[model samples]
Target: MTGEVLWAPSAEGRQPHDRVVLVLDRGELRYRDQRKLQGIWVARGDDVGRIQGRQGPDALDIGAAELRDLLCRRRGELKPALMDQALVAGLGNLLVDEILWQARIDPRRAAASLTDAEHARLHRGLRRVLSVSVREGCVPQRPGWLTSVRARDDAACPRCGRSLERRQTGGRSSYACPHCQRPP
Candidate 1:
């Protein structure tokens, strides 16, 4: 996706430069805050396969079964496992936490060890969260959303009313409810 920022010139005011920020997950494109950036990532057959939701005939365009199969192939923790685009494309770190919390599945659980029912829950959660994100825009800032209460001093889980606990997962700070999302 392309992001264009409009700003007045230095002569007009002390405003930042107008620029286009192009961000590709995992693969770095240093436009937002970088001086120099270069990469040769062609969105061809092979590269399309690497990106999860690239509108190809791969995992992105497939149904829940394909998505489940893609995720189950990874043996890592759920957080990192979901974020790896090569495995299952569209989910980022925040989405990972959001999906896991919605599914009541612990982010620390092993991906390959999840029961069929748990997998079903995770899949349903993905559909619910992702579609809501697409429709409402920006991850849905409504009640029962972790992001809505994540930064508050008294952030609590919307589902169980328990305090939302912060923990490091895959080098990122993630918030979840311990009582709801017990480790599996």
Candidate 2:
């Protein structure tokens, strides 16, 4: 999650940040990690399933009905439930925050308490945000997106222009618009 797998024309273009380099006939596939937080695993056949079995379905492929069911079965706050790799895969902190912001749902809300409409909104937001994020290969800090202003000294909600609130949710720093996302 903290590194990039890039394809270079040749090994000559490898950067100082590249941790591993694989020279192929066509090009060089390099893994670059400045922080060294990423790992490479070699799996074959059934071993692949063994690794994936520990996690939930990929976030992008999960259906709305499945998401609702998953949430209904979860405990604690929505943020933590969503961040749980076993509950929903492929979603990290930034994605959960952005999805909650887009859906106008409070991150601190009880996971199983979401209304039908809220569930729909959450699914829609997940799809919309993830489609764009997957295309960009990362969460883009666009001006209109909450990620753009979350770390600002005087951040304002991109939607309501209200002051953004910061708090610890599920052991991670979370940003939300007080006006847009009310308490559970």
Candidate 3:
């Protein structure tokens, strides 16, 4: 809430049936996201509790064994598995791609198929990615990194300097380096 919003509408957006859910704690915060087809309903105390209950441990605290267990719980590709908050929280699409790329693991590989070495690399990558994200705030403090190229139209692998591959994974545009993160 302290940082300025880089991108947002000039004013609040609303349409028919759009109503402010609540000024949380009376004039604390309001539901201000742009409304489209479905109205965005703000969460109350109970709703917040339920949602947080579904969230797993933060990326920083999860041990290698715990991470391995979470990965094994899903038979799906690594991208989707990483995106699951119920497994381990705080991983988004960008973070997942960055983590896999940093760990030198293929995004399409099955989560259950990861070897012990791969898991170790993944754990390190997760910590590094989360640390960098928290520190730099997604502003790309330096060049030649995953987040730096992931959003570019002519993105290439920062480490290998090879053309990056982009494809659909779990309904999101997943990025990977063909040279660094070889496909299975």
Highest-TM-score candidate? 2
Candidate 2 Cα outliers beyond 4 Å, as residue runs = 7-30, 34-40, 168-171
Better of 1 and 2 by TM-score: 2
Give the worst 10-residue stretch by lDDT in candidate 1.
28-37
Give the distance in Å from residue 160's predicted Cα in candidate 3 to where it truly belongs: 1.3
| Per-residue lDDT over 36-68 for candidate 2, one digit per residue giving the tens place of the 0 to 100 score | 543667799999999888899999999999999
Residue range 1-184, candidate 3, lDDT tens digits: 0122222233344333333433333333233333222334458878977767777887768999999998887888888888878778877777787889889999889989888889999999888888877786663425766778877899888898888998974456888888888754
- Residue 100 alpha-carbon offset, candidate 3, angstroms: 0.6
Residue-pair clashes per candidate = 1, 0, 0
* Model 2 TM-score, 2 decimals: 0.83
Query: After superposition, which runs of candidate 1 have C-alpha atoms over 4 Å from their true positions?
Result: 1-60, 169-171
TM-scores, each model vs. reference = 0.71, 0.83, 0.73
Off by over 4 Å in 3: 1-50, 139-141
How does model 1 fare in lDDT? 0.69
Show the colliding residue pairs in model 2. none
| Tens-digit lDDT track of model 1 for 1-184 | 1222433322233223222333344332223322222243548776765643533233235577876776678788887777775566566667778888889998888877788888889888888888887666457667878877887888889888989889774456788899999966
Q: Which of the predicted structures, 1 or 2, would earn the higher lDDT when compared with the native?
A: 2
Best by lDDT: 2
